[model samples]
Target: MGSAFPRLHVITDARPGRDALGVVTAAVSAAIGYQTPDALAVQVRVEDDVTDRAAYEFGLAVARICRPAGVMFLVNDRLDVAVAVDADGAHVGADDLPVPAARAVLGPAAVLGATCREPVSARAAVAAGATYLGVGPAFRTSTKAGLPEPLGAAGVAAVAEAVGSAPVIAIGGVSVDEVGELRARGAYGVAVVGALAVAADPEATTTALLKALA
Candidate 1:
């Protein structure tokens, strides 16, 4: 990737019964062990029904883990909690605040991310001060429902071409097997939930994801 943005984004899985913190612990540990901590970003994404307090607590835990390991930490769809926990940044989707508004909330130096699917939205988001673009549902996913159809490698290429140097992180249904093609198609990175969360060995999976991106 041309930018400093991490190539592997390990999104938190906060669904009921999911051990989001445990998964993060393992992933972060793996990143440090590989001496490539900066190549990984951990994004905390809690369910909508969860309380703000709960989100804050989770963000705090993740921050502690990431900060010491020198890994980037971000919160999804919750700027307030991100600020409260002093996260590295936040990611906003269509339903959340616009990219400009999110930039205002996070301030000029924060690493802001905006989710977009096409060239138009991608261009607008970068113009509005997004540090990177999360462009996908790159493939079908069971983690988050009601997402638009998966944007295959070609779709990622379209947004990447439009944005020039801004890093495009291909999200949703991403896995080790798909990372190479996504990168070949112009995706700067890939974001995942189940790929690591449900894996038999999260640390190993994290390493594998990083290797694939390489």
Candidate 2:
């Protein structure tokens, strides 16, 4: 992916189990992992509800394969596994541990993300010290069951406005088709799951998204 900011995060889901999602993760990592330092930020996600083993595998795979400067492990409701693996970062939602608590566990160097479905939450996340705001359901995403209603392009703009200077990452259901809208709306980046995860070629999918965003 030829992202201008060189940032592209790929979150994985266990909702479809290993065979389907695993292949995507592997391909995304291999595809964009070798770009020069200033050209890409690749993250491999291990989203699990109970079994932490998948998270562990995802973290190691990211380190070994993606070899990215950072890897954000989406801790749907757990942070311990993310810490144990020393993942590059952690993305937590409002229902999970608060930002301050996550920061404490993650330490200063570890990036902490907050999922802000609305502007109010986006403001609060910035006030609480989120490294970045995950604002989305830019479309309807089934990767995370019971996800908040679609944010659409307008929702993204609203969150970006609330964040002030903090960077905003549009996530949830975003696809290559919507990159231009996301950028025009002022999202610093985008986080994708199903689009790239279930693709026939993960690397190509990831690259295509980056190109679109650029």
Predicted model with the maximum TM-score: 1
How accurate locally, in lDDT, is each candidate? 0.92, 0.68
lDDT for each residue of candidate 1 in 124-189, tens digit (9 for 90 to 100): 999999999999999999988898998899999999999999999999899899999999999999
TM per candidate comes to 0.97, 0.83
Winning candidate number (lDDT) = 1
| Candidate 1 clashing pairs, residues 3+ apart or interchain | none
Model 1 TM-score?
Answer: 0.97
User: Model 1: how far is 156 from its true place, Å?
Assistant: 0.7
Q: What's the lDDT for residue 148 in model 2?
A: 68
Q: Which stretches of candidate 2 lie over 4 Å from their true place?
A: 1-6, 16-48, 68-77
